[model samples]
Target: MAKGQVFVSMALALLVFMHVGGIRGEMRGGGEEGDRILALPGQPKVSFQQFSGYVTVNKVVGRALFYWLTEAVHDPLSKPLVVWLNGGPGCSSVAYGASEEIGPFRINKTASGLYLNKFPWNTEANLLFLETPAGVGFSYTNRSSDLFDTGDRRTAKDSLQFLIQWMDRFPRYKTREVYLTGESYAGHYVPQLAKEIVTYNAISKHPIYLKGFMVGNAVTDNYYDNLGTVTYWWSHAMISDRTYRQLINICDFSRLKESNECESLYSYAMDQEFGNIDQYNIYAPPCNNSDGRTNGCTRHTIRLPHRPHPIFRQMSGYDPCTEKYAEIFYNRPDVQKAMHANTTKIPYKWTACNEVLNRNWNDTDVSILPIYRDLIAAGLRIWVFSGDVDSVVPVTATRYSLAQLKLSTKIPWYPWYVKKQVGGWTEVYEGLTFATVRGAGHEVPLFKPRATLQLFRSFLSGQPLPTKS
Candidate 1:
């Protein structure tokens, strides 16, 4: 062949190689032949082995299972089992639950250490955090074409299957008291999963010991959620009464649609100039750059514009608390090894904001109230707690959603006092209790560790929430 011909042939071969490599990368986990259980990095020095179990649903896609940090903890046979999930429709519980909130430990502020939380929920229970559905966290799919358009029903089913396989892996915990807890989006996840567990227990003769569920600042109803936020903003003076009234007129709380009206209303609120209003008093404004430029708004920025908010000052105190813990955690090599977290990955500072993931969550739909009602009827304890400063899922929104239950408020609405003041309020009917967390926002655990722990303790004990006057 001539030199020109040879050069053409070589170029063609290179193109083929690149194309083949790309295809292979995409196909790695789509089929039965390619399914796998992923190994977590930097295993804790403790005794637990990170195990993977596959739940074969269809021929193409299988569920990636994550088991305990067994090496670090005790024997499963002797402990109660709790399955924890973080809501995002796409979030990993291991990433958020284990790293940020009520896990056994909190990641150091610098992501360089592990500090034992004074109020770790797992201390009282054997906790297992799951990255659910097919695409969350370490969970994977062999099919590259698998739909990421997950809804509540699909997630509930996948989680139910995961539980079945998980129990089989650690059969000792099958009869142990099993509680499901999650924050934010897990509001939808927990109820649906519990409903499935209850339904399966009735039909299969093998009952999973599902005792109760807890959701913090969960997204229960979109309409009520928006309305509550507006009210919160007005109450906190985040927006003037004039702006709040405009928001009410322009935005329809009943329908959750991304319309020009909603956008314009939000834009007006964001752009509205207030004279000498304390930004610290309300949550900070949303960043305008949209390029994932800023770290999360300062705690003040994150707070909803509102007056008389419980946790207004608490946001500013997080950094000091996080720093105090980081110092202790980073000093321990064992903890560092267990997290396998890249200290450099810590953002502008080590706070819990992951802009990429947070942005993606905007598309998620959380409509699982029916599931909650179903679980309540099946005799499961359901508790919803809201951080007063979280405008996204404000306390008012939570109360609005509960009001729709029309359950004839058995106990009527009452104040829930902490420290001799009305820290928040609670209302109970049937087995469901909706309460507010005083001095807390979206991430309740970080803001009010003591109050958050108290809520969890009450949940685990199966006791009715205390009424405050």
Candidate 2:
């Protein structure tokens, strides 16, 4: 053949090879194969493949859960799968965990774009984020009744179903080591889901392998959480002695909203503690232009502008309005299409937390300590890390809950180092482990990404956090 013809043939062969081996559009899991995102709108170009779509957990309830999965930066097949859930009992993992915390891309300032995260959790392992239960973010149900009535058991079981079906789609992961972790109310969700997986595995011949689980700044025990929260407020000089006294004397976390005194006192305390401050990050700066808005992004204590898409948003200096940016990004029609989300076109806009589910959230247990004990006994790796500055589910509460366990220390408490600095303190026990993120708040990875990543690396490796940098 002529040289020109040979060159053309070679080029065609290269194109075919790249199409087959290329990283951009390969579908890994089989189910909902059409769900593969060819490319996200405005997403920075990268080689890794990402999948986002809904997994129907219950057809009767018309319940479907939304998920976003990013394979490990390298050798995803070799890396263990780490499933992350964000607590709120009503929050979206995709919103808080994926967009704002440790996901690969941070929502750009324009809300119509994305930016690469310098410290994405996907670098260490496959990151799977699910917007669980129903009526939370992109996850929803056709039955309005289910939307308003979400509880721990339903949430856990649904999460399990989602996972089992997800494994079916990605059959290769059926036996892959799975580690469950979550924060906030997920303190309850992760343990409960792990428990369900264990129960399911007891009957199934091929079980979803469970190596360990983790919860960060979680609501493990209600009484302790409340107690720690009040103490945190007062200790941080956020509340007065009188308000603290009221919290001490009258507040019961189990029915925190029922008692007029408890509700009123806590409201007053929050007013004092949260005035112009980020409730999620007490010292973080308030939004510059969005501040003082009456009814936008206020639940997360964020101030958002009236613009359809705020152009003044920033991706730098830890912007307080990141959640607003995320809301805008996730709600965009093109972005949704690229993500394969909002399949049914839910009536309402996507928000960080589901108020309907939050209002009706049925917390069965005051504490998850008993579940932690049981998992520990089962020889599952259990690690609990707390961002010390989180007043919502204060480290004090976490310590108090673990103290109730009375597990002997396998490794005496010591500061874990990261980059030659004290990242946090860690304690290894006979059954479980606990650590503190030195200056982080409710969202550990958001405030201390590097340190949290290091903590994560240690947990995944089943090794103790470093004592020296």
Candidate 3:
């Protein structure tokens, strides 16, 4: 009788220990499990959970960066975590990357609803979208001056801090492998942040398990980007021969401020490019905001409640007004509350691209190749992909920039197939991988979602893109 009681007591103790250990692991994210979101206003029902809120990078000044986390549909606990960013120096990642690209939902055409994204990144990995630095989206600083005073180094530092503190909120993710990715201006943001993480991991006891980074249609080097733009335009027959010649002969993109002749040619090129079509994807049609358009001259003029930029339009959808539709959906008061985005209720409304930051961007590295080289030397996976049709940051610019690195080709360029069709071409280099998405524009995933997913899956899995016939 005495021996039986002792055995039963020991079993109960072991069970209690296991239960406590499991709870400790579950204590992750932003809310209860750290920032666990109950649900979005119009979000589809799913077993996977989500959370959104701010990570106070600067506790004293209350400089907090907002973030949205969407768990994987299948195995949230076991999958890797991808921290995604969208570039604009001051763009809203939630607005563009999440809503438009790889995120779980897209704003419905009605601009008053949400629709499921069939190929959301959350299907595979846990997705976290951040509004970095400050004064972009709902992120803000108590010292409002920080809005105008953000730069590359400062932004990177704040981002590193946000990740660390964010992990504190979602402790379970502390040990998971992390992939940092972004597009457009994030060419700068991702590399710089990855450097910070690698540097910190060297000294810190609890380090970020950063595996790699990828940027798409990114602004890597200004000179190469500009030169490549003109080259691409001419090569693709998008610009007149005279304009192309003038740009090449007279313009010096390497110069800090372009010469009057260069500026004139550049302006002419842009004017021709932007007039009838979107500058992002050259082949895409212009957003005709007239009666024949989708909304048909509704009272909402794309910015009645929201202040739309005259020069910088909100036309991301297939019709160019999809971006405007996204703006409406995001700006809804109920959406804000559900996502826990604007806890501080900042004054300025959310815009996809923040014009203030773009104009007043205090610092920009001429070339991020040095950083890329360093990361590659550290044995980090480095991939740079481009949308072949993106005039803004065309594949030509990426090719030009990578050529400067002169990495020996490990795998000669070849077409990577998806669904038994050639999706795009890729080259695996000694320290870098270069890829191009065919028939895609500036935002590759938005233009070619399924191909983008195949590309991304191959990247994360450390596999070459399939060449099978």
Candidate 4:
């Protein structure tokens, strides 16, 4: 009734309006409040911040990419952002990258609890794991056909779009120094995405500050890769010398089609010569369970090489059945809800790699060496690492591919040390660096967590892998 009372009420109303207006503004810019994860089921207490959610790359088709961000253990705001992708071409980065390798947590054997990865990469950088393309992991598209037609070009474009929109959501990272890293098919995805980012920065008003990229046991040049692989089989005594010769002579990787002899020899090498060992990590015990299905949603009596297909399971080393655990863990309703995944209640269960997308993948660059050259010339820091014991994409294959680069060596080959022991070897070229984890398998981190952590620390700091004990 009084003039003073009326004035006070209007002031309070204005303050409330301002507060709501600010919150709305944050949401429009892709505020991360909604995405911030409180905790995960059975997860151990952690000091760092975590966030996960979907970033829609294609609104028209309703295609969304899923990402999980694990902030640095300390001073997260000061750490650079590193995006980790796992290459299935159809695999879920969440399953491989986040749940096992480099991520903050590791799923237990029973899929009932989580344990901290002693060497989590987030210690040095804000690690972001992304399940790329529409069909992988929790990432999905409303348009059913999108799954069938996914390929390199579209995946890169969508990823760039995701980053752009993701930056809008987590604006602090918009201009932060960023790096791309992955393994297996991600060998293709990482470089392709880097090229996309470099190209995009040229024209976009908001540019992603891509500093460098690193891939482990990556699928690089096909010819060299095939050549190196056969050589590795022979050198490691996995295949007979006779089979090795046949592979070298008969398998023409450059050809678009395979000859019958090549097919037979390859099959013979795998079926008979290679034995029942884990191809991803030759020395490690293979998951002898014959019932592991390709979909990996359920267990049955089946002989499995364990892990995933050669193209996607880059990081299987010690645990032969780690992927099965990932399957059991991720498929939990509580886990899905905590991560804000599978909100649509998709008809199919979450699998590590989508066979349909991998099979139907339309286009693949025969060789990523050209893109490597471009990125190298553009002065981006590039590091290619391989695990020596990986039969699928062995160290020898990576060595052969880098030799083709023909860059003069900066730091000659030398053993890099970790904990007073030889961890691996490294050589720096003018534009790129190549390293090998001496006794590791397909995925270096999974086999040699400490060694890989040193490698990553050196990479982020632009330092050489330690030459001293």
Q: Please give each candidate's TM-score.
A: 0.72, 0.86, 0.86, 0.88
lDDT by residue for model 1 (133-176), tens = 55444344444333324456667877788777666656666788
Which candidate tops TM-score?
4
Model 4 quality (TM-score): 0.88
| Tens-digit lDDT track of model 2 for 1-469 | 9855553344333223222221222233356566677888888898777888777788775667778889899888898899999876677888889987889998877787888998898898889999887766677666666654568899999999999888888887886899998887788889999999888988998798989998898777767666776777788887888878877888676553447766677566655555655555566544555454522133222110001112122225566567888888877767766787643343336677655565556555667888888888888999999988766677887898889899998999999999999999999999888999998877888889999999999999999999898
Q: Model 3 clash pairs?
A: 29-34, 29-170, 30-34, 30-35, 31-34, 31-35, 315-320
Query: Can you list the residue pairs that collide in candidate 2?
Result: none
Can you write out model 3's per-residue Cα lDDT over 41-148, one digit (the tens) per residue?
Answer: 777777788887767788676577778898899989999999998777777888888987899888877876777888888888999999876766666666545655
Against the reference, the lDDT scores of all candidates come to 0.57, 0.74, 0.75, 0.78
The 10 consecutive residues of candidate 2 with the worst lDDT sum are 302-311
- Which candidate leads in lDDT? 4
User: Residue 214 error for model 1, in Å?
Assistant: 1.4
Question: How many clashes (backbone atoms < 3 Å, residues ≥3 apart in a chain or on different chains) does model 1 have?
Answer: 19
Global CA lDDT of candidate 2, please?
Answer: 0.74
